[model samples]
Target chain A: MDSYGLLIDFSACIGCKACMKACKEANNLPGDPGDHLSYSDYTVVKQQGDVFYRQMCMHCLTPTCVSVCPVGAMAKSPEGAITYDGSKCFGCRYCMVACPFSIPKYEWNKAVPVVRKCILCYSRIKEGKEPACAWVCPMGATRFGKRDRLLEIAHTRIARWPDRYIDHVFGEQEVGGTSVLMISPIAFSDIGMRNTLPNEPLPNLTWTILRKIPNIVITGGIVVGGVWWVINRRMELEKENSNGKEGKVEK
Target chain B: MGRKGKLKNKLFLFLPISLMALLGLFLTFKRFYYGLGSVTNLSDAFPWGLWVGFDVVCGVALAAGGFILTAIVYLFNAERYKPVLRPAILTAFLGYILVAVGLLFDLGKPWNIWHPMVMYNPHSVMFEVAWCVILYLSVLALEFGSIVAEALKWKKVVNIFHAVAVPLVLTGVLLSTLHQSSLGSLFLIVPQKLHPLWYSSLLPLHFFLSAVAVGFATVILESYTSSKFLKRGLELDLLVDLGRFLWFALVVHLTVRWQDLFVSGALANYRPGSLEAIAFNLEMALLIGAVVLLTIRRTHRSKLGLFFAAMFALFGVIVNRLNVSIVGMLSDTQSGYFPAFSEIIITAFLAMMGFVAFFTCVHFLPIFPQEDHNAKAELKVQLSA
Candidate 1:
C-alpha cells in the first residue's frame, strides 16, 4: 500500500480553525487553541499578515529524530507517520535537538515527562481514514491521500493556475521530502517556513561519519597494539643487552 | 599542633562540603519530583543547556587524561612519566563517574537511564557514545582496581590486573577515541541550528584533537595541584615534558580548526562583534597563547609559566565546548537560556564531590609512584602468606 500524506493548501484556507478544533477533540486536548506548537498543542495555526499557516511535525521521509534517538523511541511508521513511544524514551531529548523543523516538544511539567509531536493521526490513517485535521477542514484546504497522488495533484494545480500558486511545493523535496506537503500563493519563506534546509536528508550527514566506526576500531587497535609490542620488545632487548655487558665485566 | 587542633582543622574543611552537598540533594529532590522545568532554564527552544554542555560534554573531555597517559606510559614505554599516571587514571575514573551522576540530573526519566543498553540503535551517534562510555567506564574501573588491590594487599587480584594491563590500556584508548569524537558527532545533524563558526564536517576531528590537548593540560594541572596540596615535591621535569606534548596538540588543533573554517567558507560568517565570533576568537586566543608560552625556553622550564600555559589551554577547551553546545545555538534558536540557581548549585556540588573523592583516594590508595616500593613490599608479604 502507498504511504499517506497531507496536502495543506494555504491559498484555499479561510482560517476558520475548524480543523484545529477537530484535532483538539480527536486527540483529547483541552483548552483554547494555541498559536504555537507545545506539549499540549501538538499542532498550531498562526497568522502571518493575511496568510495563515499550520506548524507541526514535517514527518520527513527519512526522519532525523528516528535516526538520532538512541533507544529507537522515535520511529517512522509504515503509513508515513513519525510515531513516538513514550515508554521507550529515556528523555535525553536528542530528538528535540535534532529536528530540523524543531517539531518535537517535551512534557517539561510532568515528573515523568515524554516527548510530544504530531504522528499524522497514525491510528486513523492506519484504519483507512483521513486525519482529523483533513477530515474537518471546512474549505478543503487540508487534503489527505496517497503521497504520489498528492504530488500529481499539486503539480497539476500548479501548472493549471500558475498565477494562483507558487511554482514550488513546500515539502516536496525539502529535507529529502516530508509526508506533509504544502502549496501556497505567496512564498513559503514569507509564512515562516524553514526555507534553508538541504535537499538531502539530515540523517545522512551523521551517518557518513558514524559508518567509519568499524574501520576506526580495527585501525586504532592495530596501531596501538603494534606500538605496544614494538616498544616492549625494544625495552626487553635493551635490558638483555645491558645484563650481558654487566655479566662480562663481572666475570 | 595537638589532636584538638587537627580535629578542628578537619572540621573546618568538612563543613562547607557538607553544606553544599545538602543543598545539592535538596535541589535534586525538587527536580525529580517537580520536573526539569522546575530546576533548569530549558524549554522547547533550548532542550539542551548548561548541564549537557558543561557536566557531560566538557566533563568527558576533561577525563581524557586516563587513556592518554596510559597510552603514553604503557604503549610508548615512557616509564619516566609513571609517577603521574596513577593520579591521572584516578582523576579520569572520578570524572566519568561524576559525568554519569550529572547525566541523571539532566535526564527527565532518570529511572530509565538503562534503556540505551537494552535498546539498540546502531545508526545513532548517541548509541555509539553511550556504549563507548559504558565500556570505557568498566575498563577504567579495572585499571583503577589494581591500585585498590595494592592498597588492600590482594596479591592474586593485583597479579590478574597486571596480566591484562596492556590489553586494558589499549581498549581504553580505542574507546576514548571513538566516543570523544562521537560526542561532537551528536551535533552534526543540526547544521542550520548550530552556528557555522563551530559547525563543520570536521567537528569530530576538532573534538578529538582538542580533547588530546586538554587531556595533557588536565594531567599537568592535576599534578601541580595535587603536589601542592599533599606537600610533595613537584615533578617539574615530567610536567615540562608533558607541556611539550600539550603544545604540539594545541598547534595541530589550531591549524586544523582554521583550515576547516577556511575550507568550509564559514569564515564569511564571521562578524566583528557578534557573540559567537567573540567566543570563537577568545577560545582561539587562549589556545594560541598557550602554544606560544610553551614554545618559549624561559616559560617552558619555569613552574609558574607551565602552570599558566596549561591553565590557558584548559580554559580554551572549556570555552570551545560551551560555544559549540550553547552559545552557537542561541542565535539560531532565538531562545535565551541562563542556568537556574539550582542548576548552578548542583553542578558546583558535583565538582566538589569529585574533588573530595580524588583527595580521599590519594590519601588512602597507592596512587603515586613514590609509594610503589612500600606497596611492592606489602604485596610480597601477602604473596608469601
Candidate 2:
C-alpha cells in the first residue's frame, strides 16, 4: 500500500487557522488554542509577518521518537503517520529529548502524565479519510494524498513558479524525508524550521553505538576472564616456587 | 563511656539524617500529589533537570568505583587494593538502588519504569542501558551479598558467592562497560540540539574512559573520608598506587577528548568567553590539574594532595556530565532551566542518604579489613568497661 502524506503550501495559507480549529475539534481538545503546540493543541498556526506557518509533527520516515522510545510506545504506522500509545508509555520523556523538531510535549501538570504530540490522525487515515487539518483547510493549503503524489505536486508547484515558490521541498530531504511536505516562498528557516538537520535519519546516530553492545560484551567478558585466569595462575606458581625454595634450604 | 553516652552519640548522627529524610519525603509527596510542574521548573522545552543529570547520570558515573575496584582486585589479583574493595562494592550497590529511586521521581509515570524489561526496543540506546543496569545491579547485589553474608556468619551462602566471585565480577565489569558508555550514547540522537564542543561521535568512549577515571577518584575520596571519620590510619601506599592509575586514566581521557575535538573541528566552534567554552575549559582545567598533581612525587605521596587531586577529578567528571546534559544543550534548547528548590533538596537528600548508608554499613559490617574491625571492637570494649 502507498504511504499517505500531507502537502502544505505556505503561500496559499490565509492565516485563518481553520485547520487548527478543525484539529482541535476532531481531537476533542478543549479550551482556546495556544500560540504554541501543547498537550491541548496538536497543531498550531503561527503568523510570521505576511505568511502563516503551521507547526505539527513532521512524521519522519524513520522517526527519532519511535527509535528512542524504550517501551515501543511511539511508533510510525504503515499509513505514514506517527502514533503514540499512552498506555504503553512509561513516561521517561526520552521521546521529548530525542525529537530533533522538539515536537513531543509533556503534561507536566497531570499526576498521570504521558507525552503529547501530533499523531497525524492515524485512525482517520486508516478509515480512508484525510486528517482533520488537511480536510478542513479552506484554501486547500493542506492537501493529503500518497507520499509520492504529494512530493510530485510539491515539486511541480515549486518548479512551475520560481518567483512564487522557494524551489525546494522543506521535508523532502530533511532527516531522511518526512511525510509532511512543505512549499514556501520564503526559506523554511525564516519560519523557524531547523534548516541544519542532516539528510540521514536521526536514529542512525544511536544505532551505530548500540549495535556495538554485543561485540563489547563478548570481548569484555573474554578479556576479564583471561586476566583473572592469568593473574591467579601466576600467583599460584609463585606460591609453589617459594615453598620449594624454602624446603630445599631446610634440607 | 557509658551506654547513655553511646546512645547520645548515635542520636547526634541520626537526628540530622532523620530531619533531612523527612523533609525530602514531604517534598516527594508534593511532587507526586501535584504533578512535576507543581514542584519542578521543568517545562515543555526542558523536560529533564537535576534528577536526570545529577541523580542518574553523575550518580551512576560516581559509582564506577565498584566495577573498577572489583576488576583490579579480582581480575588482576591486586590483593593490596582488597582492603577498599568491599566498601567500593557497597557504594556501587547503594548508588544503583538510589539511581532507580531517582528515576521514580523523574519519570512521568513512575510505575512503568519496568516497561523496559518486557518491552523490547533493540534499536534504542535506552533499552541497552536499562538491561545492562538491571543486570549490573544484580551483579552488584551478589557481589555485596557476600559481605553481608560474612557479617551474618552465613558460611554456606558466603562460600557459594565466593565460588562464583570471578564470574560475578566479570559480569559486573562487562555490564558497567556497556551502560557507562551507553549513557553517553543517549545524547547521540540529539546532535542538532547539543553544542558542537561537547558533542562527538566518540561520546561513548569519552564516557567510558571518564567513568573509569572518576571511579578511581571516587575510591580515593571514599578512602580518605572514611579514614578521617573512622579515626583510622589511611592506606597511604595503596592510595599512592591508585593515584598512579588515576593519572594514567585522566591522561588517556584528556588525550582522546582533545584529539576528538580537534579532528571534528569542534574547536572551531569554541569561543573563549561562551558558557559552553567556559564549562569545557573548566572541566579540562580540573582534569589537567588533577593529572599534574598526581604526577608530582610530593603531592602524589601526600595524603592531602592525593585527596585534593581525587576531589578535582570527581568534580571534573560531574561538570562534564552536567555540561553534556544541561549546559551544552542550552543554546539549542533555549529552555533556561534552573532547577527548582525542591529539586535541589531532593538531590541533596539522596546524596546524604547514600553517605548514611555507607557509614552505617561500615560501622556494623566487615566493610573494612579484619585488623581494622578487630581494633574497632577492642576500642568499643575498652570504652564500655
Candidate 3:
C-alpha cells in the first residue's frame, strides 16, 4: 500500500514563515504570524533560539483524537491524513484533550464551533499538488512524499550531517509513528515539543481499561444479586419464626 | 403558622433561587447566541473549566449516593437504609439531569448533542460514559417513579414497578460503575499535560473508589440537611451506620491511592510547596479527617459529628476532581485559567435547581419510608437508662 508523509528539516529552515502565510491563504484561515497554533491558524512557524520549527498536526498512525471521538467525527484517511467531519460531532472536545501534541484547536468564538486542525492539505494532495506549506518553502526545508520515502530522507539527512543535526527523528516512532516526521538541528524537546511520549499509541492506555467493563458488570451483578437474595431470605425466615405466621408475604 | 405566613415563608425561600435561575437562563440564551468565548474563560491551553470540572465531574460523584443506597438496600438487603433511598435517587436523577444540561451549554454545537446517539464509537471512553448516563438516568426515573406512584395511590403501577425494581436497580449500578470510571479514563491520554501526581494508569480506579466514598458521605449529608430543613425524622441510627461504611470506603480509597502512587514511582515528582502538592495535600487531609472522625466511637454516634465528616469527605472528592481536571493541567503552562462569572452563576443556578427539585419531591411524595421516629427515640432512651 502507498503511504504519504512530510519530512521537515529544521536545520534547513530559515524562520522566514513564508510557508505559514501560504498555509493561511490556501486554507482561507485568518492571518497571524504567531509561534503557537490557534483556531484561525492551521500551521505556525515557531522560532526557538536560532532554530525554526514548523508546528502542525502529527497525524499519528494510531491517532488518539480519532480513537477518543465519541461520535466518530474524526478518522484517519486511507491517503494518510487525519480528516474530520464536524457535522457528525457533538463537540465533546475529547479530541482537544486526547491529542498528545495538542494539535486540535477549538473555535470557541463561533456560535456553532467545531474542532479545527491541520488536514495536511488532503484536497491539494488529491489533485496531484504538494501541500501549501511544502510548496511555499524556498529552502527545501519541508519535503512531502511517501511515508517510507520520508523516513529514508529523515535518516539520510541525520546520517549525512551527524554534527549538524540531532541523532533522533522526532515523529518517526513517537506515540506510534506520525505521518509528519521532523529532523532537528537541536533537541526536539528544546523547541516546545513533548519528549517523553511513549512509542506506543496513547489510545491503547484508555482502551485497556475500557475493554474490561463487560466482565466487571456481569460479575458484579451476579455477586450483588446473590447477596440480596441470601440476606432477604434470612430476614424472611427470622420474621416468620418471631410472628408464627407467613410474615406479610407478597410477590 | 397561618396560611399567609406559610406563603410568605415559601416566597422568601424560592424568590432568590428563581431569580438566579432566570438570570442563568438569560445568560444561557446569550451563550448559545454569541458562543462560549463570550461567556467562558476556555482557551486552547485550558479547554475545560468550571462546567467540566465541577458541574460534570464533581456533580456526578456527589450524585453517587443513589447507586450506593440502591446497592445497600436492594442488593445487600440492608432494609434499615430504606428511608434515605428515595431522596438519594431523586438527588442522583437531578444531578444527572444537570450534568446533561451542563454539557448542552458547554458544547460548541448544542444543537448536535444527539450525534452520539446515532453515531457509535466503542473505542472512546466518552461513548461509554454517554450511553451509561443516558441509560442510568432512565433507570433512575423508573426508580423515582415508583415513589410517585406510591404517593399518588396508583397501586397497579407501583406493583409493576416493584416487580422490575431489582433489574432496574442492578442496571443503574452497572451503568454508574462504567461511567464513573470512564470520566477518569477521559484524562488518561494527557500524561505530559497532567501532573504526574494526579495522572496514572489507575486514574479510573481512583475515580471509581472516590465516587463510592463520596456516595456514602452524600447520603449522610442529604439526610441530615433534609431532616433539619423539612422537620422530618432524623434517622440518626441509620446515618451512623452509613458513616461507618464511609470510613471503610475512605480507607480503601486512601490505601489504593497511596499504593498506586508508590507503584507508579510518581512520588518523585512531589514538590512540597507546589500548587499540585498543596491541592494533593488538602485533598488527602480532608479525606483522612473524615476517616478519623468517623472512626472515633463518639463522633460516629453523634449526628452533628457524622454530618461534619460526611461534608469533609464530599469536599475531598470535589477537590480531587478539580485538581485532576483543571489544576493538574495548569502545572505545565505559563498561562492559567479561571472560570468567568457567567460560568460560576450557571453552576450555582443548576445547584439551586437541584435543591429546589429535591425539596419539592420531599414535600409532595412519600420519599421517607414509614418509620416511627418517636418509638425509636423512646427505645434509645430506654437503652441508655
Highest TM-score: give the candidate number.
1
CA deviation > 4 Å runs, candidate 1: A245-251, B2-5, B230-234, B370-373, B376-385
> DockQ of candidates 1 onward, in order?
0.61, 0.59, 0.62
Displacement of the residue A84 alpha carbon in candidate 2, Å: 0.8
Give the higher-TM-score candidate: 1 or 2: 1
TM-score of 1: 0.96
- Could you give candidate 1's fraction of true interface contacts? 0.83
User: Per-residue lDDT for B372 in model 3?
Assistant: 57
| Each prediction's TM-score versus the true structure | 0.96, 0.95, 0.94
The DockQ-derived docking category for candidate 1 is medium
* lDDT by residue for model 2 (A1-251), tens: 37889999999999898888989888888788889999889889988789888999999998999999999998889999999999989888888998989999989988999888888888898898999999999999999999999999988887888999888898899999999999998988899898899999999999988887888889878877987888787777777697765422210
Q: Which ten residues in a row have the lowest lDDT in candidate 2 chain A?
A: A242-251
Q: Show model 2 residue runs off by greater than 4 Å.
A: A244-251, B1-15, B229-234, B372-385
Using DockQ as the measure, name the better of candidate 1 and candidate 2.
1
In model 1, the Cα lDDT at residue B3 comes to 95
Q: Evaluated with DockQ, which candidate comes out highest?
A: 3
- Lowest lDDT block of 10, candidate 2 chain B: B376-385
Candidate 2 backbone collisions, by pair: none
